[model samples]
Target: MYETFYGLNGKPFSLSPDPNFYFASRGHQRVLSYLRYGIHQGEGFVVVTGEIGAGKTTLIKTLVNELSGDTDFVIGQIASTQLEASDLAESVALAFGVSNEGLSRSQIFNRLQGYLTQRRLEGKRALLIVDEAQNMPYSTLEELRMLTNHQVGDRQMLQACLVGQGELRARLQEKRMEQLRQRAVAFCHLGPMSQEETQGYIKHRLQRVGWKGRPELHQDALDSIYSETQGIPRRINTLADRIFLVAYLEEKEMVDRDLVTEVARELAEEQPSASDESEAALAGTQKMVSGQGEELMEQRLSAVEERMGSLEKLMDCRSLAKALIQSLQRT
Candidate 1:
């Protein structure tokens, strides 16, 4: 919302993964290089794992953007979890633009082979990059392993890359999938940035969004963001987005330590503990209403609470609501 008021070409704190704003830290650059090597060598599998919100997806996006179209690589980026062999085949077929209608598993494999062969003839590479691969069944990963067997001498007809969170790497250690684990030619893990890097990261985004100079996010605001978000890009964006709105609405030129602490506290409180239900119960339940008066609000609140399965999800809703209330209080 402040982009227009602040004269930014785009939202600096946008949650979406945009390659344009990619801050290629030392870790990011190393991961990109390994991924590129796997693609160039036609390696069967390259595993890239990082902590949640560590920019794994953004890394893939940046990889695709960096690869020149001259390579004529047809990349099928699948975000779904692993499926049975048949489902894996069907998903792969769909990604490759092959018609899977009425085709059995074997038939789908044949079609995929034909598609890759065609690309090979055109001197192009066919790559499959699967995201969130931790949940992929060993059975489905076996299907991927089978696909990589399509080779003409030293070059594989199709290549596969697995992008996942840390859990996926842990999953790979299972004895059942040892074959697939052994096949991985390269692997990399991204970790949280150092405090100095965190400082640079924020300023980088501010500049990429077209700010000519620093926007005066306070030094402690930087510290709090780094501490609470642990230098993860997604969380950084989330907190910064809220701070952006707060600054705009409150007409402040800079986001300060106190503002960040206030926001963080509200976020921390929203995360339900074992005592939340008792507190809710103790607060007093409303009289059971049936038809109109106030039953609807009660019903909606209950449903919202039920749907929020994680403390993180619940915390965000509370954070936003608390911000609104605080805004009103100041007024």
Candidate 2:
């Protein structure tokens, strides 16, 4: 909605990963270099792990884009779920466009091996990229390692890249994963951007989408954003997106610290933290209990008032009857 007002060609801070918006931050650049080096080696696993929304997928996408024109590489990618060993093989086959309909586990493996072999004969190296690989069980990961064992002569017919969250690294360090670890040509962990990188990232994305500084981001505002999001690319995108929207709504050209702070506060309220949710829940429960107590007290007070009124009426009637008796006796 704010794109036109901000004189932008598209959404700069979109949540979706796009290669066009890839910023070569220090950490991202190092990971990219590692990936390129691993791919050049062309025969083993290249493992990349990061926190959620740490741009691991985007880095891979960027590398793929750079390699799109190369005819020597046949790349297949899949985002893994919690898959069993056989399911993992099937998923790998399907990712490379090999049909697995009605096929048994061995049959699927044979087909995948044949596909990789065919690619090798065609003078192209097949690369399998498994994203979210941390979801796979140990058996499934072992299956992945076994897939790398497919050989055509001395050269292996396939290479694999495992991309997942930090837990994948931890899991790979276990004793059972020694075989897979031995075959890893490259392993890299992507960390969050530094504060300076965070500022550059926001400006880089904005510039990519034709931002000419109409909605100027002040330094204090940038600082506030970094403080709010802590240099995570995804979080920065989210908060910056909201900040721009707020600026557009308020018809302001310059975004200062106060505006960013206000927007951040609003976002915090909208998406409460775990602690915030717990506190709110407790407060709500207490309010309900207090309300019930007040209602019970009101009911008791009404009952007491009714009883007092009845007693007053009874006493007045008795007095009137006594006065009548006295008059009669005097007569």
**Candidate achieving the largest lDDT:** 2
- For residue 101, what is the lDDT in candidate 2? 98
Those runs of model 1 whose alpha carbons end farther than 4 Å from true positions after fitting are: 213-215, 274-331
- TM-score of model number 2: 0.82
Cα lDDT, model 1, residue 103: 79
Index of the highest-TM-score prediction: 2
Per-model CA lDDT versus the true structure: 0.82, 0.92
Query: Per-residue lDDT tens digits of candidate 1, residues 91-154?
Result: 8878878897997878887888888888888888888888888878777888789878887656
lDDT of 2: 0.92
The digit string of per-residue lDDT tens for model 2 on 162-278 reads: 999999999999999999999999999999998899999999999998999989889998888889888888998888999899899999999999999999889888876899889
In model 1, the clashing pairs are: 82-136
Which residue runs does candidate 2 get wrong by more than 4 Å?
A: 276-331
